[model samples]
Target: MPFMEFVNFYLMPGIVLGSIYALGAVGITLVFGILRFAHLAHGDLATLGAFAALGVVTIFGVSPWVALPVAMVACAFMAIGIDKLFYDYLSERPKIIVVMSSLGIALMLRAVVQVVWGVDTETYTRGIVRPDDYWGIRIRDREIYTIIAMFLIVGVLWAFLQKTKWGKAMRAMSDNPDLALLSGVDNRKITMLTWGIVGVLCAASGFFLGINTELKPLMGWTMLLPMFAAAILGGVGRVEGAVIGGLIVGIAEETSVLFIPGEYKAAMAFAILLLILLVRPTGLLKGKVL
Candidate 1:
């Protein structure tokens, strides 16, 4: 293939895919770091966000761009409610129990999507969206929006974690929850805040996915493995690491078509996940290992 062809076909898509995955992975990392369990329902939450945005677009006749924030805020609230209703009660139980509950929650979310949306494949705005060529590299408008939005959101999130008071509390809780609680940090508030952020991130991820591709009830479930792979590859609980890992996995999946069939492209993530587990369990940044 021509070098430019590679850039247009592989590298660009990889970055976009990575950006979407990064949104979800960052949430997964935060959950792992703070709650100390894998949130298996995260992708389903993304699906819910996507479907919620679709509803706004359909009912309000508004552009999906306008509905994005609406869906995010709604999803954030729902996530908080879920935390209070299901996860909070299990707090006294082993963390593993919560993980299983998360899996159950994932199924419930998917069922809701299927019953409401009827498992039909949907899109925000459908048609042939041709890409504009920029110096021999073709790129779609949605692609640009997805990448830019991902950068803006993740950058703002990083800033929040670095410069804000709640961000510090979150970090402290992730590092040592017992000490943080002893220091007078309100554990309940921090937990709620984390879920809120995770819920918003899911909306972002879902919106981008709907924009870049078609929406399906199962799409979010399909993303679960890749999101987890990104989190693991990036290093658990390290925000920057999750971003880097997401990009790597996205690029790897897109480029894998050069040597392997497209059907197995997802295997790339699995390979990376297993490889990281074997060689460097602590991850690239020495993040906490499972």
Candidate 2:
């Protein structure tokens, strides 16, 4: 294929997909770094968020873009509720138990999505969107928006973490919960805040995925492996690392189609995950080891 064809078909789509994966990966990293547990329900939460936006669009007859924030807020509360009702009580228990609970939560969340939205595949809009040509490169407006939005959201988060008092507290907790608590960091509040942020990220990730492709009940579940691969590859605690890892995974999966069958593309993430775990478990950025 010509360079432009490769760029238009493979690279551009990869980047857009990477942006979505990065959003979800950041949430995973945060939970691992601070909460110290694998949130198996994270992708299902994304699915719930996507369907929440669908609900907003259906009932309010609003633009999907407009419904984005609403879905984010709703999911945020839902995440907090889940933490309080399920995970919070298990805080003192073994991490494995919490991880298993998260797996169960994942199933419950998926069930809720199926019951509420039905199993049919759906799309936000009914019409086809044509890609605009930019100097021989073809890209859709939504793809542009997806990439830009991912950067903006992550950038704001980075700024908050580096600049704000609460952000510092969260970082401190992640680094040393015992020390942070000794210093009066208020662990409960921080945990709630983390879940809120995770929920927002989940919604944004799901919304972008839905807009770029069609929405299915299993869509976010299918994405779970890739998102986890991005998180682990990037390093568990490094936000910027997650973004880079997501891009690499996305590009590798897309480009692999040239050498391997498309049906096996998903295996790329698994391969990367194993290689990273074996070679550099600390991740590309030397993040905290699991």
Using Cα atoms with residue i matched to residue i, what is each candidate's TM-score against the true structure?
Answer: 0.99, 0.99
For each candidate, the alpha-carbon lDDT, in order, equals 0.93, 0.92
Instruction: Give the Cα error of residue 247 in candidate 1, in Å.
Output: 0.5
lDDT by residue for model 1 (1-290), tens: 89999999999999999999999999999999998999999999999999999999999999999999999998899899999999999999999999999999999999999999898899999679899999998999889999899889889999999999999999999989999999998999999999999999998998899889989998888888889889988889999999998999999999999999999998999999999999998788778976
- Candidate 1: pairs in clash: none
The prediction achieving the highest lDDT against the true structure is 1
Which pairs of residues collide in candidate 2?
Answer: none
- Those runs of model 2 whose alpha carbons end farther than 4 Å from true positions after fitting are none
Candidate 1 residues lying further than 4 Å off, grouped into runs, are: none
